[model samples]
Target: MIQVAFYDIAEESLFDFAVIIAIKEGKWILCRHKDRRTWEFPGGHRDPGEWIEDTARRELYEETGAEHYTLQPVCAYSYLRQGEKASFGMLYYAQVDELGPLPAFEIEEVKLYDKFPEKKDFWTYPDIQPFLLRKVSGLGIK
Candidate 1:
């Protein structure tokens, strides 16, 4: 399990995190773990002393069997969750040259969609939708 810590301080510490918005064959790739069963980008918490870009690269490889991609920072934002003041997120647009066979481990399924899914029950982070829309609209990353 991922562990988060809190401390009383004059300034807030952002919980550094990164995600890979991988696109392949004119489609976007998303995944869902059997435990969470929520659709999310391939990513995870950043390791201590790890560069943000490195975190994104490593998480993408670990979560999905994807390689040969490029990272472009799209957006950054902060929000509150579960009554905790947490801050952090870096969404990177990843263009992959190849889509390899993904192994089923923590991820139950890897789905590629031409258009974003319209399921209301799907687990998607709030900020991600807007970020994606902005990218698609050619407004550039915020």
Candidate 2:
């Protein structure tokens, strides 16, 4: 599992983070490493010189070999880790015209599921699933 930690303490909270749900042809794209077969959305820590949207695009392309996609911010949420509070994530919805081929770096394999798979097959950040399901089902954000 990827565990995020906060090393710096600030008076106020930090609220800048990003995640992307890359959707292609009505299916969502997820990636996993060889050792850990559980699938998750393609995302990571934002780089020093990149914007959140750029980070989402870069991660999506780097992990799934996907290009030319549209991204829209969906929602934001906070979570606590190791007794410290932090702005956990800002989730985005990405619509891709084509999925292309899988990129060799970072990602081992790409799995596209039509609907949210059984939770047993993978673990995801808490806020991701509901928004994704809503988007997939055309129900809008719940």
Candidate 3:
């Protein structure tokens, strides 16, 4: 089984990745990776010595061409699968105001959604992404 848990922002240093659940013009933004047909939030691993917030911004621009946005740290989350060590990431919520051309990256394309799509098989990280989305939604993110 895959287990997920939330952490206080005070645990920031434990985070290894940064994921952005972003919105543009009232719609959610989702990205498709070049190697997979599944959709996912714009996010990525932190670079050596880089700030977690910078990881969020860099990944957002590289994946979705999100040029202008207001980003806020939503929470920290960790996920663990049976027989595997837990992985940690910080979650961010962004209200995007502008976009530029997508940089050549692992992400193949980005789509805007009126709501997170209901198709279960469409997600790249079904075990974790949807749960995170739901948590953020309950906090009144739109």
Candidate 4:
């Protein structure tokens, strides 16, 4: 099982890696990797010299083509990779307005859903969404 850590954006005590659980209006944003067929949240590694919050903003825009949005750090999370290795990322929630053309990159497509999709197993990191939802619910998404 993936373990979760929740924190306020102000606390700012997570690793450089980040993932954003973006919500536009009332829907959630998900992306399909160009190389990998599976879908996942809009986020990526915090590049050298980039802040975690900036990483979240950049990744969200790059992946989803979200033009105008409000992004906020909801939590910092860690999970067991390959059932043993520990991996961590910052979790963010976004309220997006306008979406523009997608930038040519690792992302192939972007999608929105009112709730978790039916074929949830197709999600890139199976534990990510549920864990994020549970943690955000536990902490409350602001």
**Top model by TM-score, which number?**
3
Expressed as tens digits, the lDDT of each residue in 26-73 for candidate 3 is: 899999999999999999999998889999999999999998899999
- Worst 10-residue lDDT window for candidate 2 reads 5-14
The lDDT of each candidate is: 0.66, 0.64, 0.91, 0.77
Off by over 4 Å in 4: 7-14, 82-85, 138-142
Best by lDDT: 3
User: What are the clash counts of all predictions, listed in order?
Assistant: 0, 0, 0, 0
Q: How do all the candidates rank in terms of TM-score, highest first?
A: 3, 4, 1, 2
lDDT of 1: 0.66
Question: After superposing candidate 3, which stretches have Cα over 4 Å from the reference?
Answer: none
What TM-score does model 1 achieve against the real structure? 0.74
Better of 2 and 4 by TM-score: 4
> Which should have the higher lDDT, number 2 or number 4?
4
How many steric clashes does model 3 contain?
A: 0
Q: Please list the residue runs of candidate 1 whose C-alpha ends up more than 4 Å from where it truly belongs after superposition.
A: 1-15, 103-105, 126-142
RMSD per prediction, one decimal? Answer: 6.3, 5.7, 1.1, 2.8
Clashes of 1: 0
